[model samples]
Each structure stands twice: as C-alpha cells, then as structure tokens.
Target: MMDKNQSKRFIQFAAECQSSALYEHLSLHIAEDPELLELSSYAQKGQPMPNLIFGAVHYLLLNGKEHSLKNFYPSLVNQPETEGVFTYFKDFCLAHREEIIPILERKLVQTNEVRRCAYLYPSFCYIYDKVKKPLALIEIGTSSGLQLLWDQFSYSYGTGITYGNPRGRVHITSEIKGDSTPLLLDTAPPVSVRIGVDLHVNDVSNPEDKQWLQALIWPEHHERRELFARASQCVQETPIQLIEGDGVALLSQLSDQISTDSLICVFHTHVANQIPKEAKKRLTETIQEIGSTRDIVHLYNNMNDGDLHLDYVHNGKTYNHTIGATEGRGRWFEWNIVD
Candidate 1:
C-alpha cells in the first residue's frame, strides 16, 4: 500500500514528465502540507490521489465555484496567476472541504484521452490485416467510451498524410518516435460493434459527468481540453453499448454476445494499473480462455509493464510482442512492431 507522501511524490514526477507545471508545483506543496494530505486520504483505494484531488477542485471550479484559485487555472483565465497558487489552492480546498470530500471519495481518475486513438488506429489496422474481419471492440474501463469511436476520428502522425475518417470532426495529431513505422491504413478498419465496460460508466451527455471529465484534464493542456470537448460531442452523437460492472468478470459473457464473424479485440489503455493484481491475472486467463475457441487480440499496457503490448491468438497459435512505447497522453508513440 502506497502512503500519502509516496503517492504525492509519484504525482510530482508524473506531472513533470507530462509537462504539467501546475500539477508538478501543486503536488510538491501538497506533499509537505499535512492538512491537504489528510484531505486527499478520502480518495478510494487504487485511485490516483493527485488526479482525484485536482480533478475534484477543477470540477467545482468549472461548476462556477467562486475562488481566487480560479485565477491560477489556465482553463479558467487568459493570464493565469502563476505565483502563490498553493496558498489559494489550500484556502479553496479548506473552504470547500465538505464539497471536495464527496468528489474525492466517489470519483475515479478515468480520463478518456482521445489522442490515445493515434496508436489504436494502427493496432486495429494490424488486426484487420491479419484476420480480415470487422473488429468487435470491448474496452475495459471505458470512461465515456470516446476511444471506442476511433474510427470516426481523423489522425496525423507528424506526416503530411491524413488517415482514418477524412471528414472526421476530431483530428488527432501525434509524433511518431523511433525509427520503425507501423502499418497505416488510408481508412479505418470496419468496426462491427463497440462495447465499453467499467465499474462506473460515465455518460458524456450528462452535464455533471461531462464537467467531471473536463476537470480531469490538466489546466494547462489547452489542446487536450479542446480535443476532449470535440470527442465528447462525438461520443454523444454516437451510439455505444456501455455496461456497468467489473469488466474482467464480464468479459466472457460479453464475448458471447458478439458475432463470431467479427474479430474479438479486447483492449484497455492506462487502466490496468488500477486493477488488483489478482484481477489482472484473472483478466489475462479469461482472454486466453476466449482465445482458445476463436481468434482474439488483446491490446493493453501497464499490466506487466508500461510498454504497449499486442497479444493475439490466431489459428490456434498465440503470438505476443511489445508493439512499442507511447506517451501517457498519446502525444507520441514508437511503433516497433516487427513484421
């Protein structure tokens, strides 16, 4: 079990890596403040404490909470106040202790980063190439299910060429790192069905849910905020089947519902880290069991390590490989798929 100080330090390093100066600075201060640390203790087990606390504060601010802390947020103000933010942040949290605690206790750090679709686009293409079947996407921890709509969005990997939906409303751009390039399809592969299962499925159409998701985005990430808004609009417009339950437990039952003609592509990104070790083992076993019957592909990361992995069972043979590494936010990815 990670203590409060360790969690705070983890967030501090993570924020620095993600280039969120605001969070990096705040986390440093929060680590030293016993009161704020105590308040953060309200977060649920396995939840990222920094994200929960910051998101709670952002949710309140977006809901029109009046506070000097608002001045420090780039998402709220044109010229955000840079200095003495910790004092204002501490004051705001203390003042709204009652309101913040409920959010901290209830909400999970479930960010549906649309940009992650950059890598998903190619991975799905690879699946389609191998099996030549429409994909049945079952996303575990699909908060708001925006990523399930990857086919409906356009993408660019720092190249002049455009891919995916040409007329896509949400155009995602990512940097292609490393020397090797993965397969890129001129168009998205056909998706037969999209099913998202989560402990608490967030409905993007709901005002409160939408606000909470928006709050999850870092205050300085203007591009991410805009992408989220666009993707949320897309999610509301699209029809996706969302189930409320433990995704790992429901995998087999859900797989039975999909037509055998479609390739079963079970996937989750940046979500498995929160799952219990035992549950993670069960999830892998379940996927293997499902694979024994028919062709299935599992695309995931943060299970054994942070690198993106592609494990597919094709024609009674199982092949597993590390596809490559990816940025936390999908800002860039290295496509190292060998043949």
Candidate 2:
C-alpha cells in the first residue's frame, strides 16, 4: 500500500513518462489536494491509483457527462484549455463523487497498448527460428486480447521495410535504440493457438467495455487513442479465446490444452507490476513445472525488474536472458538480444 506522498511521487513519475501535459498538471495539483488524493484511495488494490482515477474521470467525460472539465481534455475537445484545468478537474470529481467512486473501486488499469507487438513480433520470430515449430501463445493479464493477435498486425521499427502481416489493419511503429537488432521475420510466424487469461476480460465487442478501454488512454495521447481504436477493430475481426480467472492459477491448466508439437510461449507485458509477489512466485514455479515436461517460453517484465526477459526450458535445460528494455507504451526499445 502506498502512502499519499508515495502515491504523489508515482503520479509525478507517470506524468513525466506519459508526456501528457494535462495529466502532468493534474498530477501536480492532486499531490497537494488531500480531498482528491483521499478519493483516489478507493481504487482496487494493486491497481495504479493515478491511472484509475484519471480513467474514471475520463470515462464519465466521454460518456456524456456534462461538465466544464470536458473542455480541458484533448480527447473531448479540439482546442483544450491549458489554464485552470485542476479547478475543473476537482469540481468534476466532487460533482460526480458517487459515480466516480464505483468506477475507481471496480475498474482495473488495463491499457491494451497494441504497439507493444513491435517487440513481440521479433520475439516470436526468434522462437520460431530456434524450435522450427509454430508458436502457441498464452498471454496473461490480457485486457481485450488485442495483443494476442500480434501476428495479425503489421510492424515497422523506423526501417524502410514493413514486417508482420502486410495487409494488417493495425500498423504499429516503434524505434529500435542501440546497435543490436532483434531477429524480425518478414512475415509473422505460424500460430497454432492463442489464449488469453485475465481476472477480468474486456470484450472489445461490448460497447461499455470498449468505452472503458478507450477512457484508459490519457487525455493528450491522440496517437495511443487512434492505435487503440484500430487494434480494437482488429481484435473484433479476429477473436481469441479469453478466460476470466487468475492467470497465474490457470497457467498449468491452459498449457495442458496446447499441442506439444507447437512451442508454448506464455507471455505478459506491463502486467507483472500489478501481480502480488506471492502470485508471481507461484507463476514462476508453475512455468518451471510445465517446462520440466516440455519446452516452454516465458516472456515478461516488471516481475523482479523493468527489463524485458525471455526465459525458456529447452531439452530439459533452462535458460534465462534479458532481451531488452522497452518504453512502457512501446514507443521505443533497446534490443539487447543478439544473433
């Protein structure tokens, strides 16, 4: 549990990293406003409080809530007001206190950043190259399962060449920092299966779910919002199996369903931070248990550290390596994985 000061610091950091002037200003004001900070405490345990509070407010604004605050959000207005946003923000929360509390308590901070597939694209290529088998993808904490369709999307890492599905509806662009280049296939690898497990799965087809997911995007990030809309469309067109449950608990059961012929690749991005330490331990142990029986790859980060990691068990031997460091939104990545 984070104290109010700690929460303030976290929000400050988020504001700095997100490049959202709206959120940055609001976060600074929220840090000093005891009432708003207290209200934020209603968010579900383990959820990022700043994001939840902001999303709840954004949800209300997007869902036809009449308020002056709407004028300050870039998502809502063409020319958003720069000054006195905190006043409107505070006023909106107080006016809709009851409505906001339920949302904060219920909603999880699940932003299905589709551009993250930039790294997943190359990671899958590496897996296919090594095992010479189609990959069976099992994604933990999949909000809408948009990322489960990584192979269905196209990607470009600032190169002249395009990768993955050339005809993909969702085209993701990212920057590759550093000299090391990841093994990127011209076309996506064959996927034998796609399964996503989450405590709550947001069905992209559902209007309310779709709205909530959209609201999770920050007020100023037009690009993220656009990407989200495109990815949501892609997800609806090509659906994957989504299970509603504790992903860590369901790992063993899910892996059993995948064919042995396909290389099982269990992965999650930007999700481990929300997982409890004990659950993360259980997840690791379960993966190791599964690895003992057959080959399995686990690609994840924010469990023990922020760096992206690729861990696997091949021929009864276990291997672990930090593949790269990624921008939280997949804007850029430092690929350390070498040939």
Candidate 3:
C-alpha cells in the first residue's frame, strides 16, 4: 500500500514530467481537493491502475486538470466495484510516494514496453475493399506514424477474418455482418501517398519520447507493446508525410486538393475523445463539407462530452455511424447511402 509520504513523492515526480502550468492546472480542477490528490497519489502506485485514472491523469496534464476534473472523473471512484482498486492506491500512495513517482515518470517518459497494439491495420483492412483501387491515405492523430506502414505489410486475424501482409499498426478481430470482406489488391498501391498529423509526434527511436509513448501503453496488456514494436520496425521504411499542425486546418486544405479521379481516404483512430468540444465541432463541419464529394473514412471514439459515437455523412446524407471503442475493440454499426 502507498503511504502519504509515497503519495507526495509520486505527485512531485508527476509534476516534474509536466510543466509548472500543467501541474497547477490539473491541481485546480482534477487534482484539486485533498481526497483527489490523495487518490491520485495512490493511483500512481498501483501495479495496473484503472484505465480511467491513467486516462484522467493524461487528460489532466494535456488539458487543465481542475477544469476537466469534475467532468472527467465524476463519481467514478465512489462506485462499489472500484473501492478495492481505490483502497490499494490510497495505501500505496501513503507509503511509497517518493519511489513510485520517479518510477512512473521513468516508465511514462523513458521506456518502450508501453508502445504496443498500434490498431491501425484493422481499420485500413476494413476500408481496403470499399476503395479497392489505388488510393492516397491521410491520417489524423497519426501518433508516431506507425499506421503509415499499412501499405507495407500483411496481417492474419486470429479468427477467420485475416488480411494478407504488408500490414499497418491497426488490427480487426471483431466480426462483421456484411456479405463482402476486404478484397486483396495486387499491392498496397504505392501509398500514392501517406501522411500523419498530431499535436506532438513521438519519435519512436528517440530515447525520451519513446519512454513517453511506452508510458502511454497499458502495462497490463503485454501484447500491446510487442505489437507496437513490430509495427515500429516496419514504419522505419514507410514514407510518412507528417504535418505538425491542427488536423482540422489540414483537412480543410486537403478537401480542396483531393483528386476525384483517385480515392482519397482521410481517417483517424481512438483519438477524438482528446479533442475539445469546439475543435470537434470544427472537425465535424470540415468533414461534412468535404465528404460531399470525397471518400472520407474516420474510425475514432465518439466518447466525448456530447456524443460517444461517430456520425458519417456522404453527399449530405448520413452514411455511417458507430460507438467507437478503445483499441478497435467494440461494436460498430453503419448506414450507407447508395448514390
């Protein structure tokens, strides 16, 4: 169990990983109140802390913790099922705060074991058959550009739903009801082109940021890191056009440049939740405007303030909708409008 001293140490270490402004921001909102800080102190000590807590901390650091705390954490800790995990963290924080804090910082910002399960291949395979011909792919939230390798490899799903090699980081295991499966193209189509955009892109080979990416990985799932490393290996050779600016702005630019003669697939994954409401609105509007004539495919979690589902429209009509889940795991429902 973590003691208060330990708790203090962890909080301080976490503070070090972030800038002063970030720490203060989180302290005001999410990490505010003695209990929350206490809980946080403990949570950092857990062997496999709840995803909710880890996600909360990540969000807090990125967004202001205090401003986002109430909305994000809510009363999740009080729930009966979460009591045990809560207690464990509380104790750990109370006991080993100092040791744990540095350890977590090291794990989060300096390791590679956390970079697994790049879930990009599965999503690509899902759309491969729809736009079978040669195409250019653009990805938003392209963290580390691992998905760019989609055009370079193949994947075999554990079940019957296998996709041939030259796979990307995403994978698909969930069953689909549709009669058609992804058709195999002669080749990945020369990437015609591929690019990635993110708020901050981790250099997989960079010692420091590599640790940060590793920290982002869930420790409980050992396979995730392995998968990410494997995908990373392929990405070294893949050509990725990385743009380091706002995705919404980029989409608007691409909307005008896309060639109708060729299919342009603009996609994303499990990243929408991190965007602010206003940003999301702009993104939706951008896509709605662009989808009128182009083929845009986005696979991202709808789990945000207003909606936890993704809505797609083609030619001003709804084409696809689904409740996006983490790591490409969950149910997907769609409605297509035939031209």
In Å, residue 165's CA in model 1 sits off its true spot by 0.1
Question: What is the per-residue lDDT of model 3 for residues 198-238, given as tens digits with 9 covering 90 to 100?
Answer: 76676777755554554455333345556667766666766
lDDT of 1 by residue, 1-339 (tens): 336665556456555645787888888788778888888899998787888999999999999999989999999999998999999999999999999999998998899899999999998988799899999999999989999999999999877999999988999999987657888899999999999999999998898898999999999999998999998888888889999999999999999998989999999999988899999999999999999999999999999999999999999999997888899889898888878
Backbone clash numbers for all candidates listed? 0, 0, 41
Where model 3 places Cα greater than 4 Å from the true spot, the runs are: 1-128, 160-162, 166-190, 303-318, 321-339
The TM-score values for the models, in the order shown, are: 0.96, 0.96, 0.57
- Residues 132-170, candidate 2, lDDT per residue (tens digit)? 888999999999998999999898887789999999888
- Which 10 consecutive residues of model 1 have the lowest summed lDDT? 1-10
Lowest lDDT block of 10, candidate 2:
1-10
User: Model-by-model lDDT, in order?
Assistant: 0.90, 0.88, 0.48
Of 1 and 3, which scores higher on TM-score? 1
- Badly placed stretches (over 4 Å) of model 1 are 1-18
> Model 3, residue 29: what's the lDDT?
37
lDDT of 3: 0.48
